[model samples]
Target: MSKIKVGVIGCGSIAKHRHLPEYANNNNVEIIAVCDIVKERVSEIAKEYQAIAYTDYEELLANPEVDAVSVCTPNYLHAPISIAALQAGKHVLCEKPMATSIKDAEQMIEAAKESNKKLMIAHNQRFVPSHQKARQLIEKGEVGKIYSFRTAFGHGGPEGWSADGVNSWFFKKEQAYIGALGDLGVHKTDLLRFILGEEFTDVGAFVETSSKENADVDDTAVCVLKTESGIIGTLAASWSYVSKEDNSTIIYGENAILRLEDDPVNSLVVQYKNGEVVKYELGGIQTNDAGGQTNTQVIDQFVSALIENTEPVVNGEEGYKSLKVVLAALQSSETRQITSL
Candidate 1:
């Protein structure tokens, strides 16, 4: 196929700022269709992209012209919509969190396997240039063995990005499942796993809905995590930062300390124990919340995976592993104890 025909479900902030724009920018992708429950949203996107608009994703999935789909729906609809798209013989590029439940995640994976289609999760944090560079340095033993770390993502909340603003599905417990933990925490969990090259083994957390008086879901959370290799750290995700966004990670190692997305000018910085400091002015993480539409290296990679007949960077299994950490944190919060993954 000269170009992969694509359909995007859910005309939310992610779809508008990430998936649709990136796919449109990619030379190997063609926007075949778009779907969303909101007719105006879908129609506007369809007109902008010159694609068919559908009120139901199933109709778009049924179109044989669609070679793949980007599932950008709410957390609860992610699994079902993605499964339907995959079963319809179209590859799936699902948004983060994979699913709200393990059972649903497993089902989506099984469906993808059964259909022999690519299933990639849109975990863009791993695709950041600083993150990639940090991983490389760690692999080359530039940081020595990692000791502990603190990673966090915070912002004013989804009200700035969600299509419905303050009344979006993001604030609904039934649709979002978990709030900040699912929205932002999952990215940190996945990022730690990618850079550290390990799986989380246990988690203890305090997930709460302390912000947004009207929301039933968690607006803030702090998690203490332990990796399989005995590495321990804390992960914080909150929607109460009231000011600028904070998407930073600091990893302490035996030789040096690696900081990512933490500086005003540098993207990655290393401070050695021997009084040497290194700073890399690579670039900033894609701040979709700030109205940037730069390619996230997520959409094009999914397209490349389809064209090359290869697995995506963050596949179903990888997504599930990351998601399990968040799930465990929720359980830990409720039980007031550490929960093993």
Candidate 2:
């Protein structure tokens, strides 16, 4: 099969760190074009991969040789760029949280349907080995019916990753829309849905900008979710965590309690009612890049879905569902009451 010609729409940290290298490694993909509002970054990445570069995404999308594009821009740009790419006859792999709102996400999905191009969201956590195992256990009834759960994804701040530190677009409400709830919180929201095979029906939340100085967005958020099946859970996401830990989901079932830790090594543990504990050692699920390119697996799956003519695990609608949960949390936080999904 001929390699799929791919273009990268944003030359930010995520594209530089995850998608670029992963596309280079995938034998079925060719990095043909790259675009960024900053010409220098696009040029640098394009040169590194021996591809063409553009300062505007429209120019890149107009290139007939580009078969697909990765939308790695900020939250606000996701919908517009993705819809444009779909209309341009290119498959789109959009970064997570899908979009800033359900309306925009729905528009992107409609565009993908109208264009008949594959639209996948970059929710890489669903591809983790531990997460995959946990999902299988849940599906097979190894844990029986789930009762309650908790999940969290926290970090110091985006200053370490953003180009402009505290002045980054991430801290700006206009660009990022929401803060930790959209950034780290969406991942857990998607993961919980994926693991439990249930959708959140209602949410109650508390959001605040506690640690980061002069930021307009929330730095920490805590939320309570009620699933459609009546399972209750809490989600906590923060950019103010002095020490980083992406600990997640403790699902209490009748037979066992399943715990998932998002660390690179020790990721899962299951405790039985009979005082027996089973541990799963996930030895570095990262792929081939700095910090092992943790998101590569999902990108690879997107490419494969196109090549093999199959549906992506995290398709546009699935992404929208996850975004709804986060959106509900945001509303609940603002209103100080439960919001129904």
Candidate whose TM-score is highest: 1
TM-score of candidate 1 versus the correct structure, residues matched by position: 0.99
Clashing pairs in 2: none
Query: What lDDT, from 0 to 1, does candidate 1 have?
Result: 0.93
Every model's TM-score: 0.99, 0.96
- lDDT, residue 64, model 2: 98
lDDT of each: 0.93, 0.87
Show how many residue pairs clash in every candidate, following the order shown.
Answer: 0, 0
Off-target runs (Cα >4 Å) in candidate 1 are none
Q: What lDDT tens digits, residue by residue, belong to model 2 across residues 1-341?
A: 89999999888877888888888888999999999898787888889999998998999999999999999998999999999999999999999879998899999999989998999999987887788888999899989988999888887878777656677888888999989888889988999999999898999999999998868989999999999989998999998877655556688898898878744556788899899988899744443223555554877898899998888889999999999988888888888899998
Q: Which 10 successive residues of model 2 have the least lDDT summed?
A: 283-292
Model 2 CA deviation exceeding 4 Å by range? 262-265, 284-295
Rate residue 119 of model 2 by lDDT.
97
Candidate 1 lDDT over 1-341, as tens digits, reads: 57999999999888988899899899999998999999998999999999999998889988989999999999999999999988999999999889999999999999999999999999999999999999999999989999999999999999987878899888899999989999999999999999999999999999988888879999999999999899999999999889889999999999999999999899999999999999999888988555876678998789889989999989999999999999999999999999998
